[model samples]
Target: MKTLYRYISLELVKTATTAFFLFLFVILINRASQIAETILGQGVSFLDFFSILLKMLPAFFGIVIPIALIISITMVFLSMESNNEITALKSCGVSIKQISVPVIILGVVASAISFYSTMYLAPKSNVEVKRDIERLVKKKLTMSITPKNFSSNFPGIIFYVEKIFPQKGIIEDFMVSIQKKDKLITIFGKEGNLRTENDTVFLDILNGSAQILNWKKPKDFQFLTFKNYTVELFKFSSEERFNARKYQTLSQLLKEKNVESQTEILKRLCLSLSPLIVGILIFSIAVSLPRGAFGTGISLTLLTIVIYYVLYTFSKRLAFGLKLPEIALLPDILFGALSGLLYYLSIKEKLKIHTGARW
Candidate 1:
């Protein structure tokens, strides 16, 4: 029994590992174009791009591990059943429940990994990825201001530069228009230098004059002149301001009291348990198949995965729309009940035969 268990567990582990990497590679290839456009087009360094991809792995693992487990379970059990190995075991008094021990253990292990990635690593990496992208955007914007054309990349501000000295970060004949709620503020500078500090872009204009006109009263205009005037061109969010539900850790989500947070918490927990829930369900389905049902088993595996994800997504949307966090557990509850029913039927079918013969 020990040898049998070790053999089964090792086979499962090897197959799942291969499937996990294969699925992950396929996903990365599918998204290669989008990733290149986002990272390379922004002129980000290769090292930084690689770092971002590494940071994204936890989220990918959370998605692909469960899939790999399901595929591995289906493949292994189907092969065994096709070869009449399950029948041979049953003839020797090995019950279906006893044969399922290895699968149940593997399910628990996979669930633990999924839990860690979804609850902690994925959220932390999400935050880091957002910060990295924001930093890269700021870097690109600072160097991308084109001369001889009107630039409106920054919100509420437009820049028109007659000439730019890229090496010195200086602009000549700089004109900027600032739109306000009830007024228009324009500045004209003979020369301006650009600098970035923290999350803000500062343009220090030399020998500049400002003209302000109230929108409601065009006749009420104000004018001022200065040797040096600083205009904040762009500002990115700081760490304190970078708060989103997807970017929060499990602990952070638990501390918050709100509909979105509660919904997110339940969603994460349900997703984490999905592997075990779906694993048992798939295992029961696999064991109940007749001999030489290899193609059917594979088809059922794919269909089950699709159905589970569709139901999960629908339940999550329904939960959020209805503001009922408990709805997030619907998929797990339904699948779990199905697993129990299938297991019972499989065992009862074996009992009815009473001769340990292949069905």
Candidate 2:
């Protein structure tokens, strides 16, 4: 029994580790690709981009590891059963429950890790990711504003850029429009430039024309050919509301004491539960097959994982849109439960075949 336990435990660990790495690799590649365009186009440093990517992996790994563990456990048992190792154990009087305790222990440990990661680390990292993006935008915005393009529309002002260069701090073909007390003022310049000293940014224009339109008065226009024009600029702060998925902490989701928040909480919980459920499903399907079906086991495991993730995605949208109860995650929970139950049934079927045989 000791030998059997050791062998089974070792095999489970090995299979789990392999599956984890495989999942991690696929996730990292997909994630890195999605962000690559922004990093290169916005002139974010390679080191900064890489740092953000590295921080992102913990969240990815947290989600992936659970599913990997489930599939690995299934594969290990399947391999053993196909090779008559499970039969040998049963012949020696080992019960199914005896074999299940270790898997349950593994599940408990995985669940704890998932809770810790999603509850604290992921939220903190998500905030950091946002901050990094803001920094990248701020750094690039000054450079991105160029000649003949509408940069951004502020409350009462519109800015147009002509050309910009980093080393020279030069801007050309500049225009600014401001509305003051119902008076519309338009400024056009031959050349313009930007400079930042401390927290203040200055838009400097040279040799520009100014036109003012007042509601109650005749149009007043002034054309000035000057050495320089300087305007003290204030940056736009981001005040966008965060969705539950974007930057929410797990505790906030869990303890919110509201129906919508509770629904979101359940959805996140589903994300956490996914690995175990998916793993069990994969394992049961894998083990029921004969030895020659190793390739099939791998293929099925991948297919099932993809399908589950798709279900997870669609379910979250539905849950949020419908303001579903916390129990809305029941469908996913059922799917997972069915996998385990089916695995049990498959075991019974195999046992029945053995007992009825007259070979």
Candidate 3:
């Protein structure tokens, strides 16, 4: 039994590693362009780009591991069955449940990994990524202000520049508009630049004109002109407060008593347990040598993943968006019970794991 367990466990690990890298590679390729565009005109070096990639990895791992586990287990178990390995084990007095012991252990290990990534690493990396990108924007404020496009880089304000020099942090034909609670304030400037002093960002506009319009009264309007105008963009120091639902750690979430905190806590926790739940659920679909495409197990794995993702997304939406936080664990519990039942049914029927007819 130890030898058999070792063999099965090793195979699962090997296949899971391969699948994880393949998924990671594809995701990296998909996102590479966005990262390039981020630092394209920001005076960034190749080494800086690599640093940004490493900083973004934790968040990616949190999302990718559970997905790869489903694919890996399905491929490994299906391959073993196709090669008559499961049949050989059965002839040696191994029950289906006994043969599942190694997979169950693997599930537990993967669950630990998922918990670590989601609970601490992912959130930390997310915060770092935000800070890093924000730093890039600050380094060259003009980089974010593209000509012919409106930029809402400042809170509650949007601006457009007819021309911009990102390297020199200069803009020409600048116009910014802001809505201040029942009034619209518009500013037009001949030129603009950024000023940084004591880690504070300020937009310095030259020869700018301003107009204030009252929505309630068409004639109640004001106009002004200035040789120089200064607007605070942001302040980045130890005193600066950064707070968001996804940017918080587990401890911070526990300390808060609000809908956002509740939703995030439940969501993160349930995601942490998803690996074990999804792993066992997917493992139950494996049986003897497949009969046609229906029993191949890989397609069943994909189907299970899709179904779980649907339920997972629905649960998240209900909990986070709809104020129904109690249902966050519904998918995990429901799918776990379903997996257990299917395993029992498979053992009784013997080699008939595909239950599409019943569903």
Candidates 1 and 2 compared: the better one by TM-score is: 1
By how many angstroms RMSD does model 2 differ from the true structure?
5.2
Q: Which 10 successive residues of model 2 have the least lDDT summed?
A: 350-359
Residue 334: error of model 1 in Å? 0.8
Query: What TM-score does prediction 2 earn?
Result: 0.74
Model 2 has a clash total of 10
- Rank the candidate models, highest lDDT first: 1, 3, 2
**Number of residue pairs clashing in candidate 3, backbone atoms closer than 3 angstroms, sequence gap of 3 or more or interchain:** 0
Summarize candidate 2's per-residue lDDT along 68-135 as a digit string, tens digits.
Answer: 78777767876776677766766787765566555666666776777667666777678777677666
Off by over 4 Å in 3: 178-185, 212-238, 288-295, 348-359
TM-scores, each model vs. reference: 0.80, 0.74, 0.88
What does candidate 1 score on TM? 0.80
| C-alpha RMSD values across all candidates | 5.2, 5.2, 3.4
Any idea what lDDT model 2 has?
A: 0.67
In order of TM-score, best first, we have 3, 1, 2
Q: Best by lDDT, which number? A: 1
Q: Is candidate 2 or candidate 3 better by TM-score?
A: 3
Q: Candidate 2 clashing pairs?
A: 67-275, 70-279, 71-279, 74-283, 78-287, 146-161, 147-161, 147-162, 147-163, 148-161
Q: Rate the local accuracy (lDDT) of all candidates.
A: 0.82, 0.67, 0.78
User: Which candidate achieves the best TM-score against the true structure?
Assistant: 3
